[model samples]
Structure formats: C-alpha cells, structure tokens
Target: MAISYSGYLNLPHGFRSHDILAFHDRDSEQTAERVNYSKNLLEKGILWQGMPACLILQFKKKQQVAITLLAEGGKDVSELEILPIVQRMLGLNQDIDDFEKAHYRHPQLGTLVKKQAGLRVPLSSTPFEALAWAITGQQISLAAAISIRRKLIKALGITHSCGLYCHPNAEVITQLGQDKLHQVGYSKTKAKTLFNLSRGVIENTLPLDDWLTQQTPVEEISKKLIEVPGIGPWTISYGLLRGYSWLNGSLHGDAGVRRGLQKLLGLESKVTAEEAEKWLAPFTPWRALVAAHLWMSL
Candidate 1:
C-alpha cells in the first residue's frame, strides 16, 4: 500500500514556482530522472532513513504550495520528517528580500533581480549530493557532467515504485567503490575525490550534517572542504552554495558566470576570472545570488 501526507505553505513574496522548476529541470539526462517538473507540479524521489519516497509539490493560485509525500510498500515516514527536506529542496527558508532590496537599483543586476524576484537557490536533497555534483561537473561541459551523473545514479541509487531514482547518499556511493565510479565516466581524480568525500562523511570526520545542523560559518566549512584533494575553490564554493545556501561564495571561476557577465557588460571579449571577481566583489554576501541572477540573464 502507498502511504501519503499533504500540507500547505504560504509562498514567499515574489516566489515564482516556474523559476524553481526551470532550475531543477536544467539537467536532461536519463535514468528515471530523480526530479520531474511540469507547469504546476513537481515530483521528486527522496531517501529518508534509507527508504525512498516520492514527493509532490503542487503550486496553487493564491501563493499557497501544496506538498505531498507518497511512500510505497508500507515504508514508514512522518510528514514532519519530510517537510524540512521539502523546504530545503524548494528553498523556502532562503530569504531573498535583502538581496532584492540591495540590488534593485544597481546598474547591472537591478533589472535582472526585479524581473526574477523571489528567485531562490534550489538546494540538493543532501549536502553529499551537492558535493558529488560539484565534483562531477569540474572542468567538464554541463551536458557531459549530467550524463555521467545519470549513470552514477542508475548504477547505485534506489528506485521508487513511482519510477524515480532517489539520489544516492554517501553510504550508497561509498559502497559502489571507485572502480564503479570509473564505469560511470568519472575521471580518476574525480573518482578519488568522491571516494575521499564519501569516506569522510561515513566516518563523521567531514561533519557535513553537523555543519548544517549548527549552521556553521561558510568560511569554516570551506576551509575544511578545501583540504580534500581535487576539491578546489570552485568546487568548495559551488558545493556550499547548493548545499548550504550560503550566498556569498564567489563563483567568479565559473564559466557560465563569466559569460553572463560578458553579456551583461556588452563586452566583445571574454570576461576573465579576475575581472569577474572584481566586478562581483561589491556584491559581497550576495555574490552567489548575483551569479545566479547572471545565469538567469543568460
């Protein structure tokens, strides 16, 4: 039998479900896609206590969100347990009013923010997933990275009866081993980093959960993540942004960010990383959001 729960949440001012859906739908890889977004609904498979369940979020006309979680085959999960995960995935907890107010009059991002108000950073279901994605996308085209990600999930993730794959957590990835990762098209360095990251999580040495629970400072976690081999500033920054919603991470090293800046500036030449960094410095704590707005502009 399938078990289910439903609830309603007041949408934040300027919240646009389409923007969140578009961000989630960016990767078009196969393998029983974990997240499925349509005009008014989103279906996603999420693992809780190692059991996979399907979550549905349906947007309503009055800025109210209807959330539902369906667990198949008598698997037990509480609405309380699932709501927080839903909140994170939807970025409901991330307040963007300050970012909007601060940048609404700016030269470059002003118009973009106004047009894209209530844009929130859609977070990974788990920190490990974000870290894994950052490693997977390093120095690779987005399409190629998404292809590899599909393979990885197909190889190791638990599939719900709903036909969606629950993103593999650290324990699942660790058991797959580096050899299997190579089969999924991860380079040796990336495979090694995955192994290292998964092991750290397994051993509690990385303390990703602790960091999230305690709301640790981004600099503190970034310092720790940087020590892992094959994990550079870009990886750390991207991971923190997607994983923790730390909006200050400088994404100057991202190609899409540079391209967005170039287009924004109407420059004929490519924007250098240094140039991007300098331009973004004024944004300070909202740099990642600024980068996000830039990506949307593109």
Candidate 2:
C-alpha cells in the first residue's frame, strides 16, 4: 500500500530544496527506487511489476515537510499506515540543527563540494544493514557491490512491492546459513562473518539500538561497532555517520573519499588517511556533509 502527506518544517540556515532531497534520497533508497529530481522537488518513482507508483516530496519555507502519495488505480491509500512512515522517512521528528551544524556547512570544503556534481551521502534505517552493505561493498567497485546487493536482497530480503526489498533484518540473516549466503556472492569467510553479526543482533549479544542511543560518545559507538564480526572501522564510522547521523566522523579510509580529497587539495601524491583527517578538520561537525559534497564534486 502507498500513501502521502505534506507539511512544513522550520530548518536551520543553508537548508535548501536540494539538501532535503539529498537527505530523502539517502534515507529512502532501501524502500524506494529512482528518486527523480527537479529544482525544488523530489519525486520518488516506484515500479511494481513495471507499473507506476509515485510519491512527491516538496519543501516550503525551510521547516515544513510536504508529502503526496500516488498509488495504482483503485488502491486505497486511506487504509495504509502512511503518516508515521512518512514522518520517519522525512526524519521530521529529528532535530535538523544539530545534524546541520555537525554535517552541513558553507565553508571552503563545503563550497567546493556543493559546487561539484552528483555527490550525496546515503543513509539507511538500521546500522546493522549499513554495516553489512559497507562490508559487501569493500574493495569492490560500486557497480559490482550494487549488483551483488540486489541479488542478496532478492534471495534473502523481503519486498513490500515487486523488486523493492527492505534490507534483511537480523532474524532473516540468522535463518540464512553461510552456504546460502555464499550463493549470494559472499565469500565463505564473509558469509560466516555476516551470519555471526546477524546472530549478535538477534540474540541481543549486541545492543544495536542501545548502542546507537548510548551517551557513551561517538568514538565509543565506532569502537563497539568495529568489534562486531565483518564490521571494520571504516564501516563502523560510515554507519555512525550515515546511519546514526554522527556529524564528526570522517570516512578517511574510503577510496572515494581519498580520491575526492586529493582532487580538492590538488595533490600530486595521495594523502594518507591520517593526513586526510587533519585536512578535514576545518569542516569539523560538517565533515560528513563536506564528505558528501566532496563525493558530489568528484
């Protein structure tokens, strides 16, 4: 079922239609497909067995959230539990200022990045899913990772509509043995690691939600995430930044990030990850935003 709602939000300075659309695209990739863009609007286009279902998101006056849902003919949008989903999808209840100050800025790096093309920081609902996806993507070109993920989701993940699947939950992964995972293109070791991580989530050996909400600090969250099998520091940091919305974590080890930084700095030799951190210090809280800009710039 599909439904839509629209409203306004009061946002911080530097908030633009593009910014909100970028956020929506990042946050909704697992649930939606082909978010079409224009000057002031984001149109989420969904295809169920090649039929069209659309959701249009528009922002007015910075602080408002506007939603519109389009379903197939005769489908009852009124019966769907849509408002809450829209709210969550828009992150309407979350504080945008902190996220803005920490991640979005208008400084040197920010300016360069904003001037670049097609850069975006994508987000996921669950840290576990983000972590797993990051692992699956490691050392592989993005296209390869995406193809593998599509197959993986088709094999083990559940879909709300045809060809639209949510990231598999811990329980789902726990039920899919390593052999099954290997069939989805995971190396045997990677499959085992994924299974172990899923077990951790299902058995509550790892308090995923608590850890995300814990007052222990971002560094601690990164550390704890890294302790999980198949999750490295890069994956953990990206999860915290993109999944939990931690503003200060810079994805230094990412090759894309490195390439972006090199282009930004005009360096002859690639900057080491440590050096990249120092270079990114100026962006501070908005490092992730800067990172997004950098990615877009490239």
Candidate 3:
C-alpha cells in the first residue's frame, strides 16, 4: 500500500514558491521528474540520504510555507532531518542581501533583482548529487547535459511515482559499468570519471557529505573538489554557486557566463579568463550573484 506523510516548514519573508518553481521549470532537461506543477502547487521528488520521497512546497502566507512529504510505507524521518533537507533544496535559508548589494553597485541589477525577488540558487538535495550534476554537465550545453542526466536516471535511478526516477546514488553508479552509462548518452570520459567518482566516494576518498556539514571554507572545498579527475575550477564554482550559495564564486570560464559578462559590461567581444576575473573582482563576495544577475539579464 502507498503511504503518506506530511510536514510544515516556516519560511522567512521574501521566500516565494513561484521563484523556486521557476528555477526548476527553466531546467532544459526532461520535465516530469525535475518538477511537477499541478493544482496550484508544485511537487518535486527527492531522495534524502537514499530515501525516496516527494515534497510539496509552496508559500501559504507571510512567514509560512506549506510542505508535505510523501513516501512509501510512511517511513519516518525526524523533523530535524527533513527541515534542513527542505531548506537546502529550496534555498529557504539563503540570504539575498549578498546579491542585493550587487544591484546597488549596478543599477540594472536593481530591476533584475526586483523582477526575480525570492530567487535563490537552487541546490541538489544531496551533496554528492551536486557533485554528480556538476560532473555530468561539464562540456555540454544545458539541454544536452540535462538530457543525458535524465537518461542516466531512467537507466539506473530508483523508481518513483508518476513514472519519474530519482538521480542514481553513488552506490548505484558503482553497480554500473562505463559502457552502461555511455549508452545513456555519457561520453566515455564522463562515464569513466563518474565511475571513478562513485568508487572514490565509496572508498571514502571523496568526502562530499563532510564538506557540506563541516565548516570547511568554500575555497578549501573548491580545492578539494578540483583534485578529483574531470572536476575543475568551473565545476567547483558552479557547485559552490548552487549548493553553498557562495557569493564570491565565479562562473569564470563558462561560455554562457562569459557571454553574459560581455553583454553586461558592454564589451564588444568575449573576454579572456584574466579579463573576466579583472572585471568581476570589483564585485567580491557577490560575484556569484553578479553572474546570476547577468543570467537574468540574458
């Protein structure tokens, strides 16, 4: 029998369900599993430490959000565990003031921020998932990357409701060979890197969860992530931007980000790496938000 459970999360002011949904809705990947919109509410399925559940989150009123967690067998998860999961996934606790300061420096940012208020950098429900996404998306366009991700999920992910699938966990990755992933649209190198990453995690060589929970600085985390094969500075920055909401993170070498930066700065041509850094340096501690604003502008 299907089991049902529900929960509530109190959100701070400026939290908007629409903003969160928009983030998911804009994903260039397969739609149904990424998020579902129905009956005036949005639903997303997530795995909490390998436990599958569907979360319904939406703003109900001032300082309040309505949340419901549905899982088979009514599996019990403590409030402490569930709350942080909701907060981090939806970025309910991320402060936008860091981004707001950028608007103060650049008036154009004011309009973008106002238009996209309550916009938070959405994150993977799990840290390893974040790492996996970063690795999977490398060297591909957003649509192509997400398409590959969807195929990977369907091939290996834990089954969920409505014909959706959760992102495959590291353990599942271990069970699959490189050929298995390549058939699902991964390049040979991506497949190998992911296989190695899964092994690294299982072997405790890659402690992603520790980085998330502990007080390691973003720089330190970036340093550690880059040491892994197929993970680079851009991936580290992208991960930090999504998971940590690190304001100083830059999508320095990202093609889209470079284009956005060029357009934002009124440059006639694309910028070199050093030029990008030089231009973005003035927005320290908010460079990531600046990137967000540039994306919004485009």
Candidate 4:
C-alpha cells in the first residue's frame, strides 16, 4: 500500500541544516535519499517525494512545527493512525531537553556544534527490525553492515508498491533459517544470533514492545536483552537506545561512537569501555544524541 507520512519535530537550538543532514546520514542512507529526494531544506523543514510517499515538513526554532503527507490511493490518512505513527517514527515523543542533558558537553571534547533544547530522536516502529539490525552491525564497519542488511532485506523484507522495503518481522526471520542468513553474508555466529533473536521475539521470550511501556528499569531491560544468545552488552544497549529510545543509555562499546569520542577528545586510541562510561556521565538523559553527534562528527 502507498502511504505518505510527515511531521515537524521541535528541535533544539544550534540545530542546523547540516545537523539534520548528519542525523539522516547516521540513521539510514535510504532515509537520507528519501529526505533529499523530497528536496527538503533546513529553512523549509523536510520535503520529500517518491513512489511509496512524499511529504513536506517545517520546524520553527525547534518549537512550532507543520507537516504534509501525500499518498496515492490505497489507504486513507484517517484510517491509518497516521499521527501517532509519524510521531513515533520521527521520535517526536521524546524530550529533547532531557536528551541534551544526558549527552552533555565533554570536558575534553569541547562544545557541540548544535545545542538545541528539543532535537528529535528518530526510531523504528519495528523493534524487531531495530534489534536485528543492531545484531548484524556488531563488530563490523557501518558500510559492511549496510551491505549485509541490504542483501538480507532484499531477500526477505516486505516490499511496497513503490519498491520501498519494510523490515521483516521476527516471525519471518525465524522462518527463514540460519542458512539463508548465511547466504546473505552473515558469519555463522551472526546467523545464529539473528535466528535466536527472532525466536525470542516470536515466542514472546523477549517482550520487546511490552518493555517500551513497562515500568522496568533500563538495567533490567539491558539484562533481559543480554540473556538472548548473540546479544551482548553493546547490542543490548544499542537496541535500548534506538529500538526503545531509552534515554540516558549509551553504547560504550560501539566502534563508531568510540572513534568519534577519541577524535573529539584527541585520544591516541579508542576509550576503554569503562572510560567511555565515565566520559559520557555528564550527558545523562541525552547520551543517544551525543552518540548521534559523534556519528556525525565522523
């Protein structure tokens, strides 16, 4: 079905055109293409056009916002719960101030280029997709991860009318088997991990969506995530941050984040996992944003 989605998110001060570009780049290249294809501009919010959908968005000083979605026929806007879906997808539900404080300025790295009070935190609606992607990304270059993901998605992801690919659900992955994933270039261990994660999601062993609304502490969530085979601390933390949008969470072991911090602090080598936690202490609620910025810096 063809559906267009768009919305304005209140951004924080120091937020710039480049920052938005950088954020899109960090998240997904396909999304970046969608954003650019829409011909979006900083002054004009975000503007996009394509087969699946097209849209325009405008944000004012990270406060007031507006959005327009254009879809060709299959589903009516009102019937599809568009607003809530867009809000979640754009991460409008998060508090930018909280995020900013959680990812405070580093004593050694200096100030961030943008310091807005309400920057948006983008997330995937499909937690399974996020978790699976996080697993695929472990210990690999971002470019390599994307290549594998593209191959896997092409082989298994759901496709819409305009050729837009939606991530497959856990059930689909579980049914696909480890051998299929291996064919997509996943290491044997990685394939096993993906299958195990898929099994957890399918059988309710890992209650992903429930955790989002549950009162469980981040530590508890982290522990549960780690209980799954192939999901280590870094993978769990990454899932919490991106899939669940858990504020204050940091992926200390992420190579990209570590490298970014090293460059930001002028270190000779990547910060130790322990040191990374210490270094990120000041940016409590917004550690995710700090990670976002670090990704951009690199």
Worst 10 residues of 4 by lDDT: 42-51
lDDT of 4 by residue, 259-279 (tens): 888888888976887787777
Cα lDDT listed for each candidate: 0.83, 0.61, 0.71, 0.63
Off by over 4 Å in 1: 29-39, 72-79
Per-model TM values vs. the true structure = 0.93, 0.70, 0.87, 0.75
Q: Give the runs in model 4 whose Cα sits over 4 Å from its true position.
A: 1-33, 41-80, 98-106, 113-119, 213-216
Query: What TM-score would you give candidate 3 relative to the actual structure?
Result: 0.87
Put down candidate 1 lDDT per residue, 57-114, tens digits, no spaces: 7888888888877776545566666777767777877768888898899987888888
Clashing pairs in 1: none
Model 3 regions more than 4 Å off: 1-5, 26-40, 61-63, 107-111, 114-118
Deviation in Å, model 3, residue 138 alpha carbon: 1.1
**Candidate 2: where are CA atoms >4 Å away?**
2-34, 38-63, 67-110, 113-122, 161-163, 213-216
Q: lDDT tens digits, residues 1-298, model 2?
A: 5543333445434444464465545533444444446546655544322234555666666555566656544354441345543443444444444544443354446456335422334455456766677777777887677767767776854544334454576677788888998998988877877888778877877666667555457776666667766777677666666556665677777777888889877899987889878877776666665666667667
TM-score pick, better of 1 and 3: 1
Tell me, what's the RMSD of every candidate? 1.9, 6.2, 2.6, 5.3
Pick by TM-score: 2 or 3, better one: 3
lDDT score of model 3? 0.71
